[model samples]
Each structure stands twice: as structure tokens, then as C-alpha cells.
Target: MRVSPINAACCVLLVALLGAASGAQATSIYRTTDAQGNVVFTDNPERGGEEVELNPLTVVPSGQRAPAPQSRPEASASPSSPSQAVSSPFMPYSTFRIAAPRNEETLQTGEAGNLQVELGIEPALREDHRVRLLVDGAVSQSAMHSDVFMLGNLERGERVLQAELLDASGEVRHRSAPVTLYVQRASVNLPQNPNNPN
Candidate 1:
């Protein structure tokens, strides 16, 4: 059988194209339409061909697994204040004492036996501490955050007043110097007793 020249030329062209593709890297690709309006892609730039832009390629190894997700550290659960800690290295307040109702002060209010006691603390009181009032070595009022204490119905005689500073855990941290208070209540049987309807 005689070899056709057209077929031989086609085969040679195909081999040449394959050789060019393998020998050089395809850095850019150009797209254009042929005479028959068919789309054609080639590495050679044509007169009216459009250059296609390519993004970076991502590669994954065959048998290698992705890095495990890192774990986030948990936030601290304890409080940030230093005063609340029982093992604080130093005291927060330098001056803690009772400011009002001076020692040996005589109180004669018409309200029978009511007195307002004030506390003096250097700087300021922290949220983790509390104050308690003591009368005659006994707790007259429970612990609270206020700096004032109202004593009601105090016995008509000499009374001892003291203020105690408590920590967050209800532990005594400091105590003011005891104060002596003298109460003068009018006797009911006396002529000046207002409650008597004479």
C-alpha cells in the first residue's frame, strides 16, 4: 500500500507539538477562536488571543495527614484581686480605726439609746472586706460593708464600743482601739420622763 503524504505530514506535526510541550514549561496559556468559530487553547500568543491568569496551586501529600488543630488555653477561674487571697504578703490598709464617738465620749440623744458610730480606714475599703460593731465585748450588729453602725436601745450606763475589720472569709484582720461610751437616759419615774401622761 502506498503511504499518503497528507497522513504522513499530520503524524509529523503531532510529534513536533508533543516534543515542544515536553521540552519547555507552559508559563502562560492563550485562548482564541479559530476560523470555524471553534475555541482553541495554545501556549503561543495570537493577534487577538486572551491571556488567562492562573492562581497558585495547593498541593497535599499522598499519605500525610493535616496538622492537628491546636487547642486554646482556658481562661483563669480564680478572681484577680489580691486582697481576697488569704496568703497576701502585706496588709492593704495602713490605718484602720474608729473615727467617731471618741473615747470616754458621753452621748445623751433624746432617742433613748441610739448612737451612730463611724469608722476610719486609710485609703479605701476593698470589696472583699467587711466591718462589724461590738458593744461590751459582744456583737451588737452583724458584719457589713458600711462604715457607720447604728446602736439601738443601749443600756443606760457605761458601754464599750469597738469595730472589727473582717476579711473575705469572715476572718478578723484588724480591730480598732476600744472606745468608752457613757449613756444618760432619763428615768421613767423622774418628773422629766416624756412618756408619763401627768
Candidate 2:
């Protein structure tokens, strides 16, 4: 049977619509590295490359209702009274110790006679806490937050050093083990001339 021109045109339109619909679907893409280490991408499955599956994009039309947001469980309510808040005590400084210039260590002093002090604190120091360096049983340096300190003009003798962690109220919260060290300084004594009169 001879096809009519109108029927032939309808058949062509149907085939075009099917082709367009198929083209809208995502096609598998393959990626591979060549011998020269160059990356190549292709949609041909015969290329012997791993296939990459792409997810279809979803677009929401305007004036349409969107999915409702999920609801999350609320956190437990906080204490309403100050008495409940004070029931727990704050413990700070799990470990504090002097790291540098070990006990009974002898340090050689330079012309300026400067000594460096370092501390080892676990979990680091908090903002509300300050470090104090004790030299010979006194507060030689106080209100320090840094872990390292540079001390100058140390006398030539055995010296004791300690570190204390203080709170905002200047109360000592933790004390490190005392470290003893001797500073060796050059003798300033000059030889007197025998002919010189006293």
C-alpha cells in the first residue's frame, strides 16, 4: 500500500520525538589514562575504560509545593536556677610541668646571662588561666600565658624554678614540680698588680 503524505509526516514526527526523549537521559561516560599519562574521556564502551554513572538532575518547577523540612529532636533544657549550675566544679590543668632546664642541670650563661624556660601543659592552657614562673621561691614572673619565657641576668649559683597555673582571681590552681639548675657565670675578679699600693 502506498503511504499518504500526511501519514508519512506523522511517522517522521513520532520518530523525532522518541529521539529527543532518549537524548535527554544521561549516557554512561568512560575515562582512561593513555600510555603517555594523558587523561581521555569518551562515551564509547569499547574504549576499555571504567564506566562513570551520572545521577539525573532534578529541577523543581516554580509555583509548586516543595518537600517539608525534617524536624530534629530538641536538646534537653538547661538548668533554670544558679544553684544547679554551681553543682558542678570546674577542674583545670590535668597536667603541668617544667619541661626545660631539668632538675640539677647546669646551664652555661652567655655574656648577657639569659636563660630560657619552657613548660609542658596537657590539653593546653585555657583563656581564663595564667602561668606564673617562680624563681628562688618568689613570683619572678606572673600573669604569663605563653609556655616559654626568657629570663635574663640570672645569678651564678644554684637556682630553683617552679611553675604555677593561676585562675582569673589570681588563685593558684596547679603547681609544677620544682626544677633546680645552676648558672655558671664568668668570674669578674681581676688580678691586682703587686706593685700597686692599696
Candidate 3:
């Protein structure tokens, strides 16, 4: 029952998000352990885990995030609510967004979910700022000082990604427009799959 830091962090992120997004009825969040021994959280009870009841969670529109075509962000940042990430009066960035994994790119069924993401931030990110990746609306991991993110373990399916810049205070200084990526895995039912009996 060992949990990696990344999984632990993901658990925390899910809890934080569920708490912030819950309402009067309170959406239910289920915690489960994946085959890899990684802790996973989801809304599906069928996935199976203890039900966690918490306050309503509001989805953080950590978007308005993105970058220019060739530019990139500077480095190092952390998490805070979108409320805390209000547009600053010092909005100096002209462009920012995910540059790699081009929108609609597809990963072959044989490939693992490893993703190498690049940011296009104009004027270079400010020295006082840090950048983070948002996968499907949730912060992928803590902000860092580099423009490049080597991300792995992406689930098989459609994934939306964005990059956000944070001020020293941890506000959402800037976010890149989201890029969509699909990770395909061989399905037994697929006609092209050798395992397909049909």
C-alpha cells in the first residue's frame, strides 16, 4: 500500500476540488486503489471506494491560460484557488499556451501515456513567476521554474491540457489555452487489434 508523491498529490488535488465543487446535495467522491497501487479518486461508485462527503466544489476555470507560438514561461509556482488567481493589473504577457501535443494529436495504442509538453510564453516568464500544468481543469502538479513538463501515466482517453503562470503570491497570473490530446489503447473489440475475435 505504498503511495508515490505524485499519487498522493493527486489525491489531495481531487479532495480539494471535490470540496470546492460540492453543492447542497453534495456530489459524492469515491476513492479507489488502482492496479498499480496508485490511489485514484472518481465520481463513479462502481470504480468502488469509500464515499467521501465534503462541501461543494467549484471547478476552477484555471484557463484563460495559454501562451504564444514560440515563447515560453520562466519558472517555479504552486497552487491556489482561481479566486486567488484573478487577473493582475500587471498583465504583461502577450502570449502563453501549450505548444506541443498539438490540439487533436493522438497517441498510438502501443504507446504509454507519456507526454512531453512545451510552453510558448512570450517575453519569457517573469523571474518572480512559476508555471504549472492543468490537466482537464485540475492542476497537473505544482508549478515549477521551467517551461517544459515531462508528464507520464496519462489515462487512455481524451485529455485537455493548459499551462498557468503564477505570481510570487500564487495567483493565476496567466494561463494558456487548453490543448486536447487523445491516448489510444488497443481494445479487444477493435477490428485492427490482433486480439479481436471478430
Candidate 4:
């Protein structure tokens, strides 16, 4: 085929333009803070502008091929095959006890008859573990993350309080030694005599 002079020149010009574009590198960006406390980022620099270096762009040549991605091993489809479980960084606590409000002790009722309960766990409590307070063998409080708990308006009688460590799924992992405490409250009563008024 006989090529025209104009078409050959156009083809050469197109090739040059494409080569220049492919070889071009990114310009440095400048960052500056204006007098009004506004952050400005631009390619141009003035008095207070500082040149910022950016990560280089990765370029893959068209002539060279990329490596194939590696495939992961397939898991077993059998129901009897045990799957690998995710391991936690923290281990279970060995000793869990109630630090405050000793067993068989009497506590003076506060203004609203509230009692504070504090727990002590060995190796500290894990992030996924929670504390639950048991009153008379029943769950009185659930999902307490802190070691301190407050019970409001307890009756003036002997009560049993127990602390339990539960996992994220609400499963009991550890139980503290049961603590028996007596709540004391003052009573207001009138004189038995008819004319007892002073």
C-alpha cells in the first residue's frame, strides 16, 4: 500500500504524543495555611507554601504481563470435619472474687439504700468478657463491663450477691465466691403509749 505524506506525519506525531504522556511524572503538591486559618493545597507555591512529597505511582508496562494471583486452599465440605476456630489473645481468668462488701458483713444503707459491689479478676478482664450480678440465684444485672456495680434500694434483710463473668454469647465463664451481706435500715415508729407525744 502506498502511504500518503500527510498520513505518515500524523502517525509519527501521534506516536510522539503517546510516548510523552506515558513517560510524564506527577508534579509535587504544595500545602499552606492562609491568614484566615484555612488549609490550602495546590500545585503552585507562594510565601508560606511547603512542597509535599507523595507516594510514587506504580506503572505496569503494556508489553510485560502481570503475575497470576495465588489461590487459597479450599475448606473441607464434610460436616464431621472440624473447622479451625479463631483464637483469642486473652486467656480465661483463674481467680474471680468480690473485693468489696465482704461475706457475712453488714452495710449501712445509703440515702437511697444503695450498695456498691466491686469485683477482682485475675489477669484482668478481657474486652469480650462481661460481669453479671446474681441476686438470690437469679440474674439481677446483665452485661456489666466495669468492675463496680451499684444496687439501689435494697431491702433491710440478709441477701446473697454473686458475680459472674460471661462471654460475648452470654455464657457463664467464671463465678465469684458467693457473698452474703445484711442491709441495715433505720425504722420510724410512734410511741406505744397514747399520750407519748412530747
Q: Put the candidates in TM-score order, highest first.
A: 1, 3, 2, 4
lDDT of 3: 0.77
Between candidates 2 and 3, the one scoring higher on TM-score is 3
User: In model 3, which regions exceed 4 Å deviation?
Assistant: 1-90, 186-198
Worst 10 residues of 3 by lDDT: 81-90
TM-score of 3: 0.49
In model 2, state the lDDT of residue 142.
54
Q: Residues 1-198, candidate 4, lDDT per residue (tens digit)? A: 344577557545544444445444565566566665545555555555777565454567889877878899899685421122111112466567888889998867343358888887778888888888887788887677888898877777888998877778876666677899887755545344232344
Candidate 4 has its poorest 10 consecutive residues by lDDT at 81-90
TM-score of 2: 0.48
Better of 2 and 3 by lDDT: 3
Residue-level lDDT tens digits of model 2 in 1-198: 345577557545644444344446655666565675545555667887876554454445789977978899799887645443223223655567899978898877443357889998877888878888898989886578888988878888989998877778887766778899888765545225332235
* lDDT (tens digit, per residue) of candidate 1 on 1-198: 333576457545644554455444435655566665555555566556886554433344679887878999889698735344323322788777778899998978466788889888876888989989999989987899988888888988999998888889998777777899999776756866763357
Top model number, TM-score: 1
- Using lDDT, give the best candidate's number: 3
Better of 3 and 4 by TM-score: 3
User: If candidate 4 were superposed on the true structure by all CA atoms, what would the RMSD be?
Assistant: 22.3
lDDT of 3 by residue, 66-141 (tens): 5546856777576655644443223676667778989999976656678899987777878888999988999889
Clashes of each: 0, 0, 30, 0
